[model samples]
Target: MTGDTVEAVSCTQLAYAFGETRAVDGLDLSVREGEVFGLLGPNGAGKTTAIRCITTLLPVPSGMVRVFGHDTARDRMAVRRLLGYVPQQLSADSGLTGRENVALFARVFDVARRERAARVAQALAAVGLTDAADRLAGTYSGGMVRRLELAQALVSAPRLLILDEPTIGLDPIARTGVWEHINAVRAATGMTVLVTTHYMDEADQYCDRVALMARGRIHSLGTPAELRQGLGERRRAAGTGATDTLPTLEDVFRDVAGSGLDDQSGDFRDVRSTRRTAKRVG
Candidate 1:
């Protein structure tokens, strides 16, 4: 895609701070249309902060952020209409049934009442939850809750979807199921997706391109293959002791981010470590 058609999302020198902590610092990124872009980072690395800015949940303090060429700050409503966001935390109302929750969002988005039913049904079916549509969200498993969130995000037929660690707190099977639905939605609608995840395998398998971030900065940005190739080249040049095998994205992450993968709390932290490592070795 040309830059014009491809520039679904763009951030230039984006920065955010909370008191003394610099949550996001001088970050730059671009996501193209009809592609899955993964923001891979560790916990406290500013992935969510960046998402919040792009979604217009948090105000832009220093940099420019545009969604579909509209300034996030000045054109907040226009941007909101074009984008759907599924936050890291479960958004489903435990007291409401799955269908009820989605219908609520549809109403909030001002979807026509006559069309709400079909829209909710379509979203539920898309996520393979039509059978449990009437079940309370609290009774659903972590994975089911996630799927419901995805359904809610899709109810408005947004052109751009921002998912913050969508698969967190799920078993491997459920994680795979979430990915399946995400890919299906992308394939069917050609919607641009920007996902934040600490799952290396998820990024490797699903994202067309990934940006590795650390300490509120982008360390590297490239396609999964390109990242692996770049790491391989560096390893080859580093000579025999670098590593015997081709380095995965995890290795590239470590080399670029200068950190090791340690078991950490929070799904964001887990995915971040999957992307960050101590060093790149041969």
Candidate 2:
């Protein structure tokens, strides 16, 4: 792709403060168009904080973030129009039917009144929720609820789909199902997917490229294969045995990001920790 075709997401020296706590520090990243990219890190690595900034959920300095060339701070609405985000929390209202939940997002996205119904239907089908679309979301299993959320995100026809720990609480089979639908959608739309997950294996399997962030900085960025190969090359150069099993993404992550993970919730729940850190900063 030409440089003229804008990146799906870019951050240059991006930083954020939660009171005195620096959540994101001098971060630099670029996610190319039509690729499933991941910000893989454990909790408190500033992955969510960065996602929030990119999605314009939290304010950031102007020019620090851009979506498809539109400054997140300067062109908030325009950036919002290009992305769909699913958080770690449950989004599908249990009381509502699956279709209703997705329809609500369709309306929120302002899918033309004439197109909303069809769009909602299409999204539900995309996620394999057609058979259960009429059932109350509460009746569906955890995996189904996540799929419902995926459908809601898809209803908008977003160019970028941002999922924060999309499979956080589901079982292995369910996690696989969620990714299957995600892959199907990306295949059909060539959507640029920017997802965050603490699950290294998931990133290795689904992402075309990944960035390992910890302590608010990206320590590694590359395709999974490239990262594995690069680590092997380094090991060989350093006189390590060449016959060692090929390095996995996990090994690469520990090498670059270290073991400290931000374990706090990174939100109001972290107030106590935030205050403690902020006090230290002061």
Candidate 3:
């Protein structure tokens, strides 16, 4: 593909397994450059696993995973340099000041020593953390903390930003604040975003397009309105209720995943990790 047409992220029949269990299975996905793409799913739907593979944190044990046309497997460092990732778990150090946290990421991402300070400052400003940049992260509010993490991700000026439950434990106001910063940065830089969240409302409101995953595969993919309208049409045709109001994205999620979520739910370790992150962030 040409530079202008290269996909930000592409997974062709991607799959990953943990011994006896498969986390992601034959998943095909494409994220266009400069769009906010949401990967929506229940806890065990393999969104994180797929994200790990794309981020080059996990081996591409099966099919292809590419980031900006760079094969994740063959060009690990190149892919790493092109992307910034904020995982579900908190990455900020409570003892470190906000500026320090962002600076640390800049160093890790190999930002030039001369440029690191300026990049950190710019990242902090982008996330509205300029005032709090000197404060220890532990003293910041939950919302501020999330923004700090966003700043850490932004410090590298990556082409693609991958966020796994970035606003998972924040209050509504905090969530909105985080998203505003995210959008602002995207608008300014034309960065591609690949986010995974259980909050369907966030996906419906913020994402350009979404894919609903379940049982190790995507069950639906479209713009929020398109998926909701499709389900609404099927409901009307099947003589289900509610023709007066179009179905919400949550309704579409239920129609897609539903009770089978329990069957595919992540194991004990997943539960523990998720709760730990939520508790810390909350």
Candidate 4:
């Protein structure tokens, strides 16, 4: 990003550890204002840990994290007020009606009491859920449930939206629906988006730029096209002769984190949790 480009999120030499295991290792990243930035990585590459720090859910023990010029550690509430997050785990209440769920978030975010109903309605409409807003979330389809969560995050009218694997277990149509809603809202509001996903095609099609991480650090950062072209150029220069077809985002992913069999790739617990989320949403 250019020096003059506004940054919505910035991290400098950020590091975090779990016991003796380092989750994030001296990472530096910046998400420019009003752009969709994707953080792509295998499990245990520290993507979630880094996100937790940026969201102020975890302390920045070793370095700095800033959201829209406010330090996360120094101005936790300020940072929280500017951000709307949808975590990988399910956050929607199946027992409550969709409208109720969003209204609850509006209260949690301290939306003005007078504007709460209007904001809740706008959020539901933005996600194509207004017609079903009064239905209990337990009766919702998987796609509807995910859209409800998105509505919940949007009720606060946040400046920055952070999504952790927002489309994790959805089918192709559902995934596209989620992205369409996200893009539509972003275009209308100019809100900056930060997302982490393992789906390379989604990253290529939706993200303006992406950072590939491995071993708790960034290995590559560029637009999807740029990263793919870079890999093609390197392959041609090395006389691999496999350049008959242009490389893909998945190819770049493999190039950055080959096999993903390293000890730091993830643990049994990580596997279980990811599977659980996928199953629940499935």
Tens digits of per-residue lDDT for model 3 on 124-239? Answer: 99989899999999898877888899999989999999999898767898899889999888888999999998788999999999999986789899999999999999999998
Error of 3 at 106 (Å): 0.2
Q: Give the top-scoring candidate (lDDT).
A: 4
In order, candidate lDDTs are 0.86, 0.84, 0.90, 0.90
TM-score per candidate: 0.90, 0.88, 0.93, 0.93
**Candidate 4: misplaced stretches above 4 Å?**
1-4, 263-274
Candidate 1: misplaced stretches above 4 Å? 1-3, 240-242, 260-282
Question: Ten consecutive residues with minimal summed lDDT in candidate 3?
Answer: 260-269
Residues 70-141 of candidate 4: C-alpha lDDT, one tens digit per residue = 999999999999999998888899899999999999999989999999999999999999899999898888
Residue 160 shift from truth in candidate 2, angstroms: 0.4
Better lDDT candidate (1, 2): 1
Which residue pairs show backbone clashes in model 3? none
RMSD (Cα, Å) of candidate 4?
2.4
Q: Is candidate 2 or candidate 4 better by lDDT?
A: 4
